[model samples]
Target: MADAPQTMVIVGGGLAGAKAAETLRAEGFTGRVILLAEEREHPYERPPLSKGYLAGNSAREKVFVHDPTWYAANDVELHLGVTVDRIDRQAREVHLADDGVLGWSRLLLATGASPRTLDVPGAELGGIHYLRRLPDADRLRATLRTLGRENGTLLVVGAGWIGLEVAAAARAYGAEVTVVEPMATPLAVALGPELGRFFAQLHQDHGVRFHFGASVTSFEGQDGMVLAAHTDDGEEFPAHAVVVGIGAAPNTGLAAAAGLELATGPGEGGGVAVDGSLRTSDPLIHAAGDVASAEHPLFGRRFRVEHWANALNGGPAAARAMLGQEVVYDRVPYFFSDQYELGMEYSGYAAPGDYARVVLRGDAGRREFIAFWQADDGRVLAAMNVNIWDVTAPLQALIRSRRPVDPDRLADPGVPLTEL
Candidate 1:
């Protein structure tokens, strides 16, 4: 008698989940590949939602990971608008919200994260927005266009990547923009104070107002529409529309309910704990993308990264591991941002306190520079190249090498990074 064919179940329809399914077929996995997505639309990438798509530079078709026909052609089962309510680990069954159940030989969780919302009053007002899904971006794009034509004000909360990116887009649309942040400078948590100030100045140069060291205490609205925002500093700014970009929390409710171990260490970002191979506590299950707190071999730390690059690579790694292939899943953390004419790419990881000081090469004033975040012992923890090209390989190599570099040589444009 022949054995029953193996079935692999994947939850979430974002980049990670979609790529995982594609990888299964690419690696010659003849078993069943079932992908369940809560969202009605096909799997799409998120970066364009905040960048080109929001700016109206890219069309809607460009966001999708694969064409609609690709899934069926590849013999992968694509179930849309279906939510996984519960994971019965003991029985290896997935309970759907619509009373459907699926038994899987292996499971992969790539549920991703959700945007954090404001607790202030009037947050639910009609003019407020959060950019996460395709629908959200479509609404935001229309709102920005309307505001621009009317010469209205756009109040953005938080100075993080999303907030700043939207501000840039709004400016391009010719809407007046104001950003309110609790931190001293924009991107302070990720890039430190000095570089944060540089970004602040960049936005300021483009006529975007900044209200730093302030928090929104309440929002004033009329007819169920947000009209203004009030800060704890006793100030109020007129807001025709508002966009909240406070950050995101991973979708770990399903995993936690199933008794899967979660990363609780400070700064692990509260994700499902996975080993270097992206395998979860139960060997039959694995986690990837934003919801995965993976133990990294290179950094010797377990961290969760919410970025397009991570999702693009993590899903394939998890799929290979699921096939019993050797996969370390130790790619350096990477992310990029585009605000106006400035474009930057950052590789490796380095929070504010993790690095001693920042070393710069090239001209920062001209916005063409490479900044290195080095530890006290001169080991490069991370590197960011602003408006620079063709240097990601050498920068990442320096990080993986774990070799202390001479600050003077690193700062010299005459010295090649590969030589250093």
Candidate 2:
């Protein structure tokens, strides 16, 4: 490409931003690259925040995506603890909090998301917390440390991924943990009720309690510290520490302010809607990671994924698009999680209620199984393997093939997925 942009600026110094910067230089782009991170530390992974970090299994330095010297060596100008106020799309500039500005030929909005806050009364109490940044995980680990040293109670609101991971960490640290969710099953929207109940049973076997179909109305405490949770049904639960993980709200303020088009209609999950090339409504602007609601060429619908693999792959795809190269972000979505002794990996794209049946291989009772979800059209929508290894490749292929499958063949351990 001749006369490429002079400068490429990436907003939000998370995994996506870091990868985008890496991809630019790797693609032979010699332009100035500035990666702005709101945090004072180097870009780091977020999954460990609840699993390894909070459980005292990961060291501090292990979380960083790269060493401090990597940025300087790669000529990637790194700015930490900087607040970007707005995107001046008209002038191709980013306004800083202190009224400074940086001109960019291309802009990538990797600005992730924030934890959804509970609207209940006494929400500001000290013992209640949310996990998003490294500091939040650090504080929760400290609380878990105290609980491990003695004994305490932890009330976790919402049964989403983060909530369940935190609950597993807290319980592992010797805390008596209780999780509350308005949904009858945890992750009902994602995994459906059958598998969700399997997870509920897993937690129960590990000594964790659950309050299903319950809503929190307020928190009661003394000394401005959360001590108890009050439910709408007039039930009082002891809560020495409260951690909320309802879900994440995408940070799309700058995109909205810049007049970038967003998703619309029922299937349009909200965010900056982008095409297969990851180009937003504004040609000069690109949105990746959690902030981008990019249309999936495979699913025939837009999907904004917030998993590690998406951020890892989408960043480079967006960078290629920014460089005037032809690229389609058609990679099947993938995600993995660890809870207690169970390690599960899932791949494919399926919105809520897209799958009609789940074909199970191996026994769910033995904690070693693969659940393959199929749509009404007989296509494999998604699949999850617990305590299974090295199977995501074929699982992804099955999804990409989009062919009808025999349930018996799908459930046979002797049958290789490729044959199906």
The best candidate by TM-score is 1
- For each candidate in turn, the TM-score is 0.99, 0.98
Q: Which 10 consecutive residues of model 1 have the lowest summed lDDT?
A: 117-126
Model 1: per-residue Cα lDDT over 1-420, one tens digit each:
997899999999999999999999999999999999999999999998889999989999999999999999999999999999999999999999999999999999999999999997878888999999999999999999999999999999999999999999999999999999999999999899989999999999999999999999899999999999999999999999999999999999999999999999987778999999999999999999999999999988898999999999999999999999999998999999999999999999997678998999999999999999999999999999999999999999999999999999889999999987
Leading candidate by lDDT:
1
lDDT of 2 by residue, 195-310 (tens): 89999999999999999999999999999999999987788899889999998878988889889998765756587899999999999999999888988888888878888888
CA lDDT, every model vs. true structure: 0.95, 0.91
Clashes of 1: 0
Give the backbone clash total of model 2.
0
RMSD of each: 0.7, 1.4
Q: Give the TM-score of candidate 1.
A: 0.99
